[model samples]
Target chain A: MAEFFTNPLVQSVLVPVAGGFILTGAIRFANGRAKGPLVAGAAVALGFLVGYVLIVGLPPLPPVSNQQKLAYVVAGGLIIGFLMDFSRRPPFYRELVYIVGAAAALYWMALPKIAGGTAWTYLSLVALWIAAGLIGYRLEKSRANVVNACAPLLVAALGLGLVALFGRTGSYSQLAFSLATAFGGFMLWNWPIARYPFGATLLLGGAGALVTIAYALALYTEASPYALAMLLLCFFAEPVARRIKLPAGKIGEAFRPVAVGAVALIPALAAVAVAYLTAPGQEAGY
Target chain B: MRTRSIIAGAAALMASTALIGTASAADNYKIDATHTNIIFIVDHLGFSNMIGQFQSFEGNFSFDGKSVEGASVKLTIKTASVDTDHEARDKHLSSPDFFNVQEFPEMSFTSTKFEATGDKTAKMTGDLTMLGVTKPVTLDVTFNKADKFPMDPNVFIAGFSAKGTVNRQDFGMKYAAGAIGDNIGLWIEAEGHKQ
Candidate 1:
């Protein structure tokens, strides 16, 4: 816990989540939707969590051969956009059931190996991202919202782009870039939505970004075998904290997931670097 | 007429066999360091594989068609010449994990048995010493071609390639289990001239 508090990545992740919540809260309190800030905060937090889990926990995915990783990025952006359009309204059993089932399906579809260090893996990732966007569109239809639909698709695209590019290189870089991109997108999108209901698109893009980044990080880097656990910690943190009645901006509230991401990122990168340095049998064959 | 044809065919077979035996006769040859190559490769990560080759070495081999039954082959690879572009890694390869130049300086492979499998191929079993561990390995030997040297016509060139795999652990090299695989594949292409 002490180490977590002192880490740079943890510091980086929490600053925005807590600060954004406060800013959104102030804006909502003034606009008479005192709950608006809370809603936006929840969406941001949720996006971050889902993204972190998918990237860090998974195995090295198969690479797409025909196209580059851009395909995955575009697909992810579109999904988040679609989802942002949907997730609004009173709690309904049918929608909830569909979301749960869709998430499970996405997880299953993502299990095939995609990291072949070829263009194919990137292309497949893009296709999957786009499919997720379509699912987001369905989720938005239930809520009858436009801004929310766009948010998820946009965020998914951005997140997928980060993963495809930075994730191609290293684990720590993936986590760092993913968190940075998703958080930034959320902050920018939250401003307009807190004043008005932009719909499921916001959540879709935000969450999609996080998910794609996390998945890309996991696929490319040997950062953590338990990336899913870290992501879950992120995803469930707000709800869990709310259950215990911790204030939105409290230190311990969002600290857990950030701490986990940091812990996984650093050591994994060091080990990889060490292996590269100490590699033996220096002879090339013809 | 049948008896005459049978005798002629037998005579032709004898003549051809004798001509081939003389023409393809083996002689003692020195492995020209300038032309020979020694290389090995392994998976760098799940991502890509890497290879390295020794640029220099000296060895000599010799045999005769009359003494193909007792043919012998030998090679001595310089422990220091291990190159994979990285200096630090090359040193480690020559260390205890590989050649271990301090303890056992030069790696040598000497054949104990040679069996001609066909017209241009043979199987040579030999003991290879590396890191002070000696193990028997068989070479899939192929006699590529033989010709008089362009520079020195008196000297003939006999090209041969021997390939085999040796477990690095069998030679007392066991480090980097998950990172670096165990099996060390080896290839030797040596040219020999009548010495």
Candidate 2:
């Protein structure tokens, strides 16, 4: 029983999902509308924080490794997201926060790499920040919609997990899966009925987690950028789901998240396929 | 008598000059990468030990064979060059879980001290930096011999073999932990040519 609990899958994936589900459920059950949604925003972040701590733990004061830097970046993004949820801020305000937050994190993270004065490296840094930052900004904007928020991002997370796995980076794969399962837990509340607000907290955390996971894999592992690019098409999940016609009853209401999920799974599966087909050919060592 | 005293003073002056010329200076040598090997070993599931090697490296050392205390060595190994006869495993090793070659491409070592334990054996203490973490390591080094190379008599060569064990976890290489074994045994065989 102890061994079972200590297993990597249980510790990394199950524990975080449980944490998110329980906390969000608690907030929905007891709290009134006063500041419930704002507090509720913290549930997914809490889940991710759990998994992050369990997997990578806390980094040293002066983070030396890339993973350590990643830990700090994710924390900063979530805090910014929480601040966003504290107010019904204008879209420009949100955009400004996202832009500045992304820029600051990228600057801190890419300092050493671009400090070498390689023009190409600097350009790549800019490109990485733009791509990752855009996904995060858009994903946060999608908090109110089901097709774009939890369900579709869930599919995207699963796809990223598979890509990381086949790319031979177990850490990134585990992180992606942890985020995917956390989204799944949170979806339990919203799927049958909307009991809680999906604000910047959950969406931003979800988006930031997915984006950073992909970014790390792209930079560190042999994962195909083409595969990641295919996964990027997940942004179209909500738009695609918007076009679908639904039945006129409770059945449609429950099936809505599922239907959107099915739509999102296409790009995800395509990403996985590309990852597998393009994986570096190598013999697995025993 | 005066002539004898003057000749003795001149002889003393010559002796001092010869002593100054014989003062020990460290001899510099370029590490012969072609003739050197850096090998590592780790336990595999408690059933066996898996051995691996790094293919690319460059280094040099200064050693006065008579004075082991004055010897110093520096080496840099390309972490991406790690090989274990399995390509996938090598890729895994290069990932963040192990060497993180993308973020930290090179592992280096520079000796801080050398303690002679015997006529031909000494311990070399140095800071080994890997995965962006540095730890002091002491290797049991044996100076095998120093002489002219058999193939090229014009080149003077010094040969040595060193072995050490390091906890990869100490360097933040927290991968499979116990299952993969933390204590990685390192074996280095090097021959340096005097330069």
Candidate 3:
């Protein structure tokens, strides 16, 4: 049992699942059944908590700068809080607040790193990512609840890919993995058959976390830009899936997630290929 | 007139003694980047030691022959210049897993105290800052030589050899903890020119 706990993979998967269940139980007790926006909000918040705990426990904590900490707290808090509130209100101002808050947080963190043209490039990328998330939220809203629920699972998959492509030893990669598993546990209650509320908020928050992790990797590590671009491209999968006409029946219902998965895979695979080829040294069978 | 001449001669003798005292004071030397080398070794899977070096580093020291305790040294190494002679491995080492060069680009050391153990050996205690973590480390340093340059008679040079060990985990480099050994051995041979 001790040896199992020592393993990185085991630690990463186990903690999040346990945390998710605990949060689920707490929310159910508090709300007398854990249905609606409250459950979704609790899951997202608790999911990140699990990841943060794992990072803290990992032998030596990486020295995060004050600016980085501020960015993470402000951006993560605003996005989660805004989504949760928007689930109840559906107010335009809620999203506006999120956009502005997240942008300011990223700018603060990026100020030390950016100079001249790089500053503009960083700003543009942040703007584009916010735009992508908002557009994704709109697309998920119009679609069935299952589409929104599945988005977290997709983010989890991306996190796993980051671990495999880069190294699992990194705190960022482990945090990403933990976040994914947490969402995975929550996704069970949010199946297509069950009409769990605030599916949109859960999906958008999951996507927001994924985007933040990817950007952080790019900024702080040798993480390839191509990989980041591919992750961003996955946001368009929802809108594109909506355009495709399918046979109306059980077949279309089964095909929806598969289509979205396939669309996401194209860029993901390309990104992996680019990473392998462009990695410092070119070796066969990479 | 004889008494005045005697006082004048004594004043002249005092001035010459002061000049000699100032001339023999501590000499300050600037580290010669081209000649100085910083190398490190770590156990690789318990099979063999993996050796690497930093290509870019600079430092300066003030050395006094009479009072070795008064000497001080400061060094700064560019973390990005870490090279293990393998490109892929070097890249991985420089990434977030090891040094995290992007976030913390340089490692620095500044001496707090120096204790002379022998005529040519001393213990240097300093704070070494790496990956944004500062820790006190003591290096066993040997004064190799100090002499006028053979090529340029006017220039003076001083050289030292130092060895120390530090746990990588101490500086937040916990990646591949078991696979790669935690204790990293450091060997530095530096030559400095008087400035």
Candidate 3 lDDT by residue in tens digits, B28-93: 999998889999999998999999999988899989655568789999999999999887677778
Model 3: colliding residue pairs = none
Model 3 chain A weakest 10-residue run by lDDT: A58-67
- TM-score (0 to 1) for chain A, all models? 0.37, 0.87, 0.73
> Candidate 2, residues B2-45: lDDT per residue as tens digits?
99999999999999986664454668899999999999999997
Fnat of each candidate: 0.00, 0.62, 0.29
Question: TM-score of each candidate?
Answer: 0.36, 0.90, 0.81
lDDT of 1 at A183: 51
Query: Candidate 3, what DockQ?
Result: 0.29
Q: What is the TM-score of chain B in candidate 1?
A: 0.79
Query: What is the Cα-based lDDT of residue A105 in candidate 3?
Result: 50
What local lDDT does model 2 show for residue A130? 80
A211-254: candidate 1 lDDT, tens digit per residue? 44444444433223232222222222222322343335545434
What is candidate 1's CA lDDT for residue B58? 76
RMSD of each: 17.3, 4.1, 5.3
lDDT of each: 0.49, 0.77, 0.66
DockQ for candidate 2, please give it: 0.48
Please rank every candidate by DockQ, starting with the best: 2, 3, 1
lDDT-better candidate, 1 vs 2: 2
Model 2 stretches astray by more than 4 angstroms = A1-6, A26-33, A87-91, A116-127, A133-141, A146-148, A282-286, B1-23
